[model samples]
Target: MGPLNGFTVIELGGIGPAPMGGMILADMGAEVIRIERANGTDPKQMRDVSARGKKSVVLNLKQPEGVETLLRMIENADVLIDPYRPGVCEKLGLGPEVCLQRNPRLVFARMTGWGQEGPLAHAAGHDINYISLTGALFATGRRGEKPVPPLNLVGDMGGGGMLLVNGVLAALLETASSGKGQAIDVAMVDGAAQLMWMFHGFQAIGGWDASQRGANLLDGAAHFYDTYECADGQFISVGSIEPQFYALLKQLAELPEEEFGNQNDPALWPELTDKLAAVFKRKTQAQWCEIMEGTDVCFAPVLSFMDAPSHPANVARNTYIEVDGVTQPAPAPRFSRTPSTVSHGPHSLGQDTEATLAAMGFAESEIKQLLESGTLGR
Candidate 1:
């Protein structure tokens, strides 16, 4: 019922990005099977949103029988997501060379912070370290303050997971034509850097000032593009960058032309910002919403996580959904036909192991042997 309805993806499960990529594919109707370690930690708890719409199979890759079983599954799988550090899959005898040899049309997608080979590829690092290497971390936060971590959204989900999904889809398309598959090396550092292309272009053309963080147009320095606190201490964001929208903001806020006329003057920005802040503070958020929410002023109240699902715009669009008593975002990039859906909520560890192995043509006797040997978890 989705765009990737017939495709099958094998997710070598880990934390952070790889699971997110797998969930995206599953949401798009790909039959995603997560390969979890028999004795490894279950990264997803009861409310873990990223585990949605996927099936789990526990396999002890340290066992030769388990590796052989995975190879058998790879023979018919379309995609494999590897989320480990470099050479970990090779140590398990499940590297790209082995897997691609087993299935010529398989897409082997590998994700990492530092990529396959580099000085720091073997070193351990998190999203903060990866984004710090790029300019993403440094460009964030207020001026004169240390860079704040953007909650792993930039490096892990945006750069690592989404980049892997993109590469997988592209490779799948190419394989459809050439009848050959390829390996994808997705690095968070590389993807995060690529994400900064706009700023890089701005810097190249002198449209951006890289000298200071908050002095730039979009970096909270501009009064028209920053968040303001309302009378009730709630926050609202304003992005009235266009002159017409800026004029509307000025009119709605009742700012005199003499004080707010020169909108783009950098020297006047501080004084004007103070005046605008004071004006916004005079009214509560609801009052400001009544005055300026849906106008050409480009305004929206800053909604927290708990408050976001119930927002009028989001509720109208069904942007958030509830599954198994947990509220999370719905499948995105709506399609005119074959729209995506969440088939089911998260499954327990090894919930589908026996059924999956049986579907993979493992005889009942062999399944019993594997289970007895601890190659397959209960």
Candidate 2:
């Protein structure tokens, strides 16, 4: 059994981070029921990995009876994850105010790009846009190049969905002791800003180069903390920051002491990086991995999506698992007594409508009426 075995979460289906938050809750043993639109989302989007370990129930929230039915279900739910624009949920009659009024113990989690109320709250944006406003995007990329978009990892998944999960859990824990529920507002841009705390500290100390990206120590400016191309066109990364580790890197790579010295001098970083790149390219990625894979020099080969599952270290840790013939990441942050597992992969649209309503204690007649009214799609 999982830690959240007895908790019930109602997920209002949307894209990106909201589903990911629900997936995290579901993975942790909560019984998550995704309330999808009756008409369904995009055909191609149904294959999302975040749908794993969740039950789907399609409902037409446009109908007043559908909203009522949803509220009734909320009566038994411990958490409700809302993924919509600012007033969309309120207009649909399922907003935090109304839902919390119906169920005082329900933790309402709202995930948005901008916050619930802000200058840009109503504006449509995506991961890149959200991260851009947070200075996180500007901090990425080479010194003279344009900011690099981090592929939605920073805003959407990490800051947005992960923040919602954390907020929901924190509120849930608080509710457990207070016997009262509260609303959690998670904005991707705000979360992205929060993720920049370390950089903010560096800036305060004048250690970070705010004017030029990729010039900071942790960025690609550091010769010892960047990726290098190998002879086979593959790549490996190294992070020999400490003096001892830096010496080990030089010793193991057989570099001359005269050339590899001055490890911490930023002025010599570019020249040293060029030399390291040339030397690394002399050997294949596999050869480099063999020399430094598990050593203290802080090195590893760059593994891609297709290569990650089969990597020796990943295989040893069971970092990924195959379910129903689909290879994906396994549930993470294992617990000692209540280890989590994927119950199943994403289900077809409305696959659990009837059974879920039945479990919700809806009368057979009520279920049939909702089906007949086209409010509930099976």
List lDDT for all candidates, in order: 0.91, 0.91
How close to the true structure is residue 106 of candidate 2, measured as C-alpha lDDT? 96
The TM-score that candidate 2 achieves is: 0.98
Write model 2 residue lDDT over 196-235, tens digit each, in one string.
9898899899888777889989879999999999999999
The C-alpha RMSD of each candidate to the native structure, in angstroms, is: 1.1, 1.2
> What TM-score, over all chains together, does every model reach?
0.98, 0.98
Candidate 1 clash pair list:
none
| Count of steric clashes across candidates, in order | 0, 0
What tens-digit string does per-residue lDDT give for candidate 1 at 327-356? 899998799899999998888888889998
Off by over 4 Å in 1: 42-45
